[model samples]
Target: MMRVLVTGAGGFVGKHLVSELKNRNYEVIAAASSSREDAAAGKLHGLDITDLAAVKAFIGRTRPDTIFHLAAQSNVMKAWHHPSAAVTVNTVGSLHLLQAIQEVCPGSRMINVGSGDEYGLAGKQGMPLSEETACQPQNPYAVSKFAAGQLVLQMAKKNNLQAIHVRAFNHFGPGQEEGFAVSDFSSQIASIEKGLLSPVIRVGDLSAQRDFTYISDIIAAYVALVETDVPNGVYNVCSSIPRMISTVLEHLVQMSDVDIRIETDVAKLRPSEVPIFVGASGLLEQVTGWKPKTVFLDGLERTLDWWRSRVGL
Candidate 1:
């Protein structure tokens, strides 16, 4: 069996990825920032990527055949407030992992997960951003991720490391935290349906459009990339279809039992916002024959159901 080490294995996408890999009969090392004894227990291994010595020791010890570096400080707004922390965790932490891999597991194939926010403010160029498009990061999170991505690419070329950088767009599904827009909307809708809160959903910047991919699709893309013999470079994982936030909220309301009213909350709005953001996955498709299988409505329904179950509605 192939040995795989997945950082951030406790995260929303990381948990799903670990499950999928296990189902595929791969030996997966579920590494997380912290391990919960009740839920993760024996399966989860504690790993703080921010610590270079710790990262080096873990990689040297396991020497996994494949390393999926999904660990990062992923919140955009939070990054804005704590730029230094974001850079340390996202950029410096990535550097630590790469250096450890170079020293201990140079032959291991690695995938660094970057964000579509790396192409910030460039959505004005046109629809469907391609891999060749130059990244123009707008926020601290994007800047840090972009810096880490560039390091991955540079190390791949200079050190001849077998690594690939993935520029994943907006993705959401069941178990996602309320920090994201879709999850926030779904959670609010669930609370309203369960009579835990008022029948009003507070939202921010409903006019902004983003390319949303189901979490399952994103995991599939990662699996496909790891299994393939594709060249080392950056690839965009996205659905290429932009949906307005308002439309997504409408879908969630329709899926819920209670009638919900949308109310704009200035507190929820980002200081810097991109009007529209979408990505083209032509490169990923051509290389791996991977395309999103889940339709938008189906994903929305599943997310709503998950939230409803959590709220016992």
Candidate 2:
């Protein structure tokens, strides 16, 4: 069994990934940045990636066959408010891990998880983005993730390390928080179902289009990259399907039992954003034979159900 270490194991995607890895009988060592974010992480190893010395010591001790780098300051609004912190965690933290991997276990492969948001304005131009797409990185989070991916590629080439970056698109499913569109809609519907909030569902600009993959499908894509002997480069993990937020909202609203009124919440709106972001996962599929398996509607329904369960409905 290949021993794999997953950073940010407490996060939404991390939790799902960890479960799948364990189910596959991999030797998994899970670590989180702190105790507060330890729900899915198990708090087994509070490995702070920002601390260089600590990161080095932890990697040296674990010495796993592969390291899945998932740690990041993922919230966009938080990134805008604390750009330096975002850079510290997303860029510098990744550097610490790469440096540690180089020194302690040069043979260990690392999968640096990045965001599709790295494309920024460029994503707004094309129908579907590919690996060759130029990254403009609109926000602090996107900029930091883009920098981290570049740094990883550069270091991997120079040191001959087995490292690759993945530009993962928007993924949602059960147990997701209210940051993204699917979860936001689902959570509100769930809240209304549980009688926690009014029948009004407040929302932001819902005209934007995005590439959304089910969380399980996203995990499968990452696992495919791990299992297959693919080349060292950036790959997109997406469904290659453009989904409008309004359509997603309509689906969730239809799922609800109560009569709901839509209300535009100015607080929920972004300062500025790309109108659309759809990625081509052909490279990922061609290499790993991993096409998206879950239908978007099924995934959306499951997400709403998960939210309903959470609220004890």
Model 1 scores a C-alpha lDDT of 0.89
- Tens-place lDDT per residue, model 1, 46-81, is 899999899999999999999999888998889999
lDDT of 2 by residue, 1-313 (tens): 8999999888898999888998899988888876554556454578989999999999899999999999899999999999999999999999999999999999999999999999889876857999998888889999999999999999999999999999999999987888888898898899888889899977778888888999999999988987999899999999899888888898889987799999889998873366778999889888889999998889999999999888853
Q: What lDDT does the true structure give each of the candidates?
A: 0.89, 0.89
Q: Give me the runs in candidate 2 sitting further than 4 Å from their true place.
A: 35-43, 264-273
Best candidate (score: lDDT): 2
RMSD of 1: 2.0
lDDT of 1 at 293: 99
